[model samples]
Target chain A: MRNAANLRVQVESMLESRIPSALTPKIKPPLESMSCGISDIDRFKAFGRGTLVEICGAPSTGRTTLLHGLLAQCTAGGEAAAVIDTSDTFDPVSASQSGVVLREVLWVRCGVPRNQGRALSRLDQALGAIDLLLQNGGLGLIALDLANVPIRDARQIPLSAWFKFRRAVEDTRTLLVVLAQQPNAGSSSATMLDVSQSSVEIEESDKPSVEKHIDGDCLIRTLRNRAEVLRGQMTKPVRSVRTIGEFSTSLYSYR
Target chain B: MLYAGVHLPNFPAQAALRNDAEARQKPFAVVAGTPPQVRVVALNSHAKKMGLWVGMTKADAETQSSVKIRERLVRLESLAHAALQDCLAGFSPWCEDVAPDLFVLDISGLSNLMGTPVQIAKSIREQARTFSLYIKIGVAHNIDSAIHAARLTKNVLVLPTGGEAEILRDAPLEILEATPEILGILHRWGIRRFGQLAALPELALSERLGQEGLRLQRLTRGISTRILSPTVPSMAFEEEMEFDHSVEDLKSLAFVFHRLLGQLVLRLATRALAAGEIHLTLHLDLAADGVTAKEPFFTRTLKLPVPSVDVTLLLKLLQLDLEAHPPGAPVMKVVLHIEPMRPRVVQNGMFVPQGPEPQRLELTLAKLRRIVGEDRVGSPELMDRHLPVPFRMANFTPSNSPSRKLPAEVSQTAVRIFRPALPTSVEKVRGTPRRVRFSGKSYQVSHASGPWRRSGEWWTRGHWGRDEWDLVLVSGDNKRIVVRAYRDLVTGHWSVEAEYD
Candidate 1:
């Protein structure tokens, strides 16, 4: 009985040596989405990768405020972003002031049209530029600034183009943000934020024009206003551009 | 232990025959010197069979038989010999170039890896054949014996160890390179065969011929062993192709390019390397009418974003670049040279977001550059100045390090600049621009601040002085817009410089 037990043990050990140990394959975790860093905005929604976000509003509606917020968030997070400016309207001075790492952002300026006659071709050029940027993946966010281009010309951008952009960002962790005069990406956008100014306060400047005024005049009214932020689909009626005074126009500086 | 010798009798002719398939079939010899004094410097196997030899007058050879003579390129012979040495290095690292036509390789331990002596010889012969070289290989116990066996044998001869003396016994003494005086004395003594030399009394021979004769006897006995001082082998990863006719179509040219790139990539892979930069040289076929015919050489370098051996990616990049900058004339010849580098080994962090392949990003950037002007594309870099729009374009190279998390404490207003500031007409009230007309629209100033003055570069051209204002304007529809308008103090012109978002 002892000999049989020894033989059995030997056979078991040999079998164990012959069979390789099984290893568990590593499962990768999901990547985190980039946030705009605004308490009200980031809390409500974060700009996920492979998604399109649109921000459009009338002039002084804080459309640029949101755009800069996203740029600062991306650059400060140590990620690179590109802005395809259709009207050549990117200010580096203000971008740096907003905590944006200018080194991380690729700014491409498509020359602005001098008149309405050149607007159509200029828009086409901008679209072509955006297409190139979209294909060059590795960016955290690609903001298409078409706010200065006429809304009619921007609307002329076919749905197929938007669909192509949607497909390009599908598998990659890049957020495509379109800043236009109005909602243009339509249903192709995953999140839409419509900004519109509700009121304007005219504050007379305390500095006298008599000091060193050019054109021999003084004290132009200073602009002060609040804008409403409507988040969701543009087709919905529940979202309105009514100011709850949550937004401020005061100078926010960080050294 | 064993050694081997690879000897090509007429190296110059063989080197010339390389890559010329049609010429190899006919009897040919390479002639040197000018005109009447020209003599045959090297001959091929067919010419040898026709009783032609090197140093024969070129005129005499041409008259004696139907033979074609080509100018002997001394420079080409040197380069080809060096290339042959590099090719042989693939088999064994130890190779000594005893002569321009002959090389001895240390093949002692290669039998297990490459096969028997005959198999190894055949493999080396095959490699030489790629360069259109016909060679004889001899394997023996020592380098000198291997050289003698290779020079005398038709193809391959393997002299077993301890049999070198016996094998060399029948070989003639003329094959030995001895001094003329020693040779005359040996001839007078009738010591012709190596066996006779080996049988000579060592003390007598040494006393008569001194150290020279004693060394010769030792060589005849095959007892000498010396290390092979191999040249430092350089990597050659370049290939050239000349089309039968000029290739006007890009597709045809691309097809040829694809094949050449594949060949080069394979060569790099053999050496465990990757191409850092692929330089392409195109020889264009100029039109008959010499209308501003620029020198027909057009060259471009495709610098890989990252060193890679992947053929598909490289081909795609080349295709895109060529499409952007097409050749001015039809291409007759294309030569590709690769700067080789070791492939980078990257270990990605587990938590890092996977970015696009560097090669892919590079290709895309190139395409963007083509679409937009070169100056218009790339990352934005802030220039050192307080001037409005102090920035320039720089190359876009994204870092692969871990993403930085900015503290929430820092926040500031962001500003976007207008490339060419918009021209505007302003209505000044109390020395402030209270109303503005821009883009065919009027904005009633709701509130405004600043007449901040700035000026610079007064001594240089493009001197500038400007007064800036931050304004909030309300249109007739009650829509409000914030803008910064600057007045050029020199020209007294007001323009919208930028918009705040």
Candidate 2:
């Protein structure tokens, strides 16, 4: 009886192995993932294709820095990236230092208005642009940088827009990153990272650093003895809120 | 077979019917001449069935109350002829527009590019279908035989090589397109069909009827000793339409543009060419001293990134441009000129990531430009200078050319400049910024570096000088802000310049 039972078990295992793959449930391989180019944040979460990532933080919290890193990683892999810059705060010189290929990056600057009401209208246009870019697809990364946009104006953005973007990016290898002062996309995003500046440390120099800072619209620039870069750290929300490391990387330091 | 001919039957009636669809399937005749004595130039089959002949006087034709008559439009005849010539240009370089309703092409060596001569004839007929024009094609060893065969056949007729005379024997002498006097003399001689005309002695006909009769005899014998004077293709691919009335709405304008673009694209495709640029000139009906005048023109030229023949893409681009820069008055006439060029062949790199389609990319860029101001969208190109944020917006044309490898010593740090640098109040400790106040908020400068001085353009009155500093500031909440601030040396004012990403 024991020998007969062993034969039955062997026959069952052989049948299972012989079954065509089409007859069984497919085990999908893991999704293609990429790092945000920041070691501290990469450990907790990595961006994946066809996913929405939100980087929310107040002004001067390294939101722009995180955006640069994402763009850099995308372009460094020979992929193209774009920034729908609401409030017109994208600085190419600073972005290039974060390892972004400027040639591969498309910078679309939404008009910056001085009044609050006009600023809200500008936000609407920016959202439309986001939808346009998402529908167009083929982009490795599309960053909607609204960090400088008023929080109230950013809030006026309909939640349905986020869901629309989520649907547009599904089954595609494009990453949609929304950078804002606070979380605006709600639950539609696949990954939500809250960035904050924890501390500020200014490097000391004997002579004041004054490199040429061209302000064409204002036309005020001058040269100084030395250049300074400010570095800082944010440590909290170990799981959700990610802080930026390598704060010492300054504008002059990259060049 | 070396030559082919296209025959458009009842051309006048058909041309009129093209613009008046309701008149189709009706007994109609196109008449031209003085009113009472106006004679029918062409009549449709239904009209012919109604006993309306081409020479019938208008008054007599009107006696048949059911027959409809439309004045022959000379302009339409010319346009249709040009259109036919453009279409036939694709088959062979030697195309002769012999009449308003006739075309002959020299297809001597097109067997390799287009199959056999019969296939070429069929292809010509098929391409003409796009215009809803029905044409009969004939191919033969000589032009005269080809012309005769085209008129006699219902569709495509290919005469056997060296058998033109035998095949053309039954055709009517009118197929030769001979003069009325010669035709009258031939009729008096009882030579109605080509066989009777060809049976006459050539020397006798030449002696009696002169050159005209000799040519007729040669045509009847299916012989063409004359050289083919092919019309040279026009350099400019252009179409013009003058509206019956001024069009004030975009929809009507777009509709007209759609038709024009279709015809232009067909012309370009026939020659294996693409449009490099579209120069659209709209004649406006603007009021001069409150009087409607018609000379004002609004011209806009759209340059294509790559030569393209895609009608939809071209139309969209044109519509976008028109939307952005609308004419000041109603449009009375529109002319479209296409610059023709060979399309560029692009070979994508093996490792480079795929980008959006070039046509799509250009269209998307145009849309973005409309949404934002024109100067706000484009790839960033750094200006060659030490000036901060020294760059300008330019036309965006994506390059597939390989990017140059970066130097080992180039800096990796990039700075994002804030436009209209935020004006700030600074408390300087011995000419060094120690505190900053901007947007009703103040920050203590934890660390400050700079006083870098750069000034130039002394030759002009607009000279600039500034003291710059890169600072790490601590807000009241102890939130950190890294910024680059500058003080105007001449104005004695301070402003926040840019932030390091």
Candidate 3:
């Protein structure tokens, strides 16, 4: 290790006038990450503070579950958070089951019918709400849920809008997470997670675990899913030791 | 103890000037009582020059060419009285509400902080000008002497202590505000000044006018020993303005709101209070239309998250709300009322986490409500019922002290609910095998859960019963999904309720 350090110094000194320490790699400060309060995801990757994150997946792929986990951790730690539901799909019981303090969350539901012709359309209104939340800078977390929106409509959102949101939250402690079926924030997202259902091998004799006498109604089964980090902080992805994360859900919603 | 008195002359005319610039230049006369006996109770100098005396009838005052005759509004006078007391309270706390337009304060021990008596009186006069009132101030050794001195002085007068009687010797008898009967007798006896009234034989005055006559005689002689009656600060905080030309646009109306909110905020700050709620009323100009509209006023009330005296924030919230629900017609008058509250005091700990600021969050919610609908922004509260999707929206108020109990390491997965459940076709084979189809997609039931029965609201007109099912469906290509499905017992309709994540 000592010989390698000496060689790097000698090479940088020889190329000082030409490239100004061209052999030395530029080091960046480590990004601070807030725990999602779930070992399944935290073991692999955690969303960074003062940065934009995106969670995209197919239906029933644990997209909302991950967002709820992040919110629960934020609220339980004595901070406030907000969710702008573009499709009016936020379930209060499910969020409560996820351990989120309901009082600490500001839920803004976009229930207006789609007025495509108007300048301030449904998507624009949602974006405007997010902008307002960003301008008021004390919230710990803000999630924008656009999962149920059609991809065709979501693509109409300009790249400049994402850049604007990224700039707004760049240096602040607010962590903005966007939920959708596809990564709509383009390159502006500091971290993007692609999710899908993780297949579990089950033998015919090995039936799924079910609660027999407790709930007295529906049978419960454990559902599993996986997430892969598509992009993240630290110019190179070498700092991340784990690449994929696996998590599960309850079949009958004990929540 | 040195006492000070501040009195508003011609209070009825002054109260009528609710920021009306024309009332100061033009002749103004305020009348009271019913139709036959309505007489001018107060008149400005310009009105006095136009042959409009205090005893003239409203009709006679109208006959004078440029006289502006207005009815006496008790509300305006009360508000003016409140403003007068607020101004005096800044100089000293022990102020007495003597009359609608008169107040006296005990300025005995303010020498070190407020300099001499003359300087304190000068400071009070400046405060009255900020309140849009023309007042006369007086300082004397006794309450009655102070009151009479205010009535006699041009602007301000401070009499030396221990010589109150000599200083007020030349003041007229009317300055005492005595009973009319005693005044008539004093006039018949050829006494028009305080010096003359003091010289009358004390025994002869008591025998003729009884106990009341002696009280008046002593009051004029500046020998009053009455204690000061403390005044309580009023809770009402409101400002009203009437425009000569009706305002039709929101942008123009915001300027008016800014002006009014500044005054209200300043008043609250003077009292060390904050506004907890705001009530606004816009008197519409519906008289211009040919049709008769019974309700011509548009009103809106906003309850703030916390008590705040921030003028910009209050104005922004008002502007946003007015933009959402505008008045149907042009507004002729606007009244803004505030509910006062003690300002919140918070001692923040160093280890405490940061949250959304109450004032800015409230402002953000108002802007969001304007963009979305009013009912779309708030915290969600689960209803206490067994029915499907039971919940209500409430205003979000984050507690300062968060729950100390932390969540477990492993999180419970949440489900995404479809607001209106989608209808689907399910083919059941002996209640075991099934094929579900929805939104032009087909799925085979790889595994199925039992049918959970749930029902509620049986006694009301809206009754519901459903059999819920949890199913793990697999497509032809092996893509899998888990969803909650329910069958309505009344309509026999099957729908996909929510997708488990």
Best by TM-score: 3
lDDT of 3 by residue, B1-501 (tens): 989988899998898884565678999989999989999999889988877789888888888878877788898888778877777777788999998988999999998888999898888888778777899988998998899889889899897876777878889999887889889998998899898888888999999989888898898777888899888878789888877678777788887788778767877877888999999999988877542435788899989879999999999999888777767688899899999999999878898887778898899898888777889899888889767878899998888466788877544667788878989899886564389998789999876665778889998878899888877789888888888888999999999988877
* DockQ score of the complex predicted as candidate 3: 0.43
Worst 10 residues of 2 chain A by lDDT: A224-233
Kindly list the per-residue Cα lDDT of model 1 for residues A76-136, writing each as its tens digit. 6667888888777777666776667777777776664322133435667677777877776
CA deviation > 4 Å runs, candidate 1: A1-32, A75-78, A106-137, A198-246, A249-255, B1-33, B36-141, B145-159, B163-223, B234-273, B277-305, B310-342, B403-411
- Measured against the true two-chain complex, the DockQ scores of the candidates, in the order shown, are 0.23, 0.26, 0.43
- Cα lDDT tens digits for candidate 1, B244-272: 57877777776777767765676566467
Local accuracy by lDDT, each model: 0.73, 0.73, 0.82
What's the distance in Å from true for residue A205, model 3? 8.9
lDDT for residue A229 in candidate 2, whole number 0-100: 17
lDDT of 2 by residue, A200-251 (tens): 4333333433532421112112111111111111112223443333332334
Highest lDDT, which number? 3
Model 1 / residue B61 / CA error / Å: 13
lDDT of model 3 at position A40:
72
How high is each candidate's TM-score?
0.74, 0.80, 0.86
Q: Clashes in candidate 2: how many?
A: 31
True contacts kept of each: 0.41, 0.33, 0.67
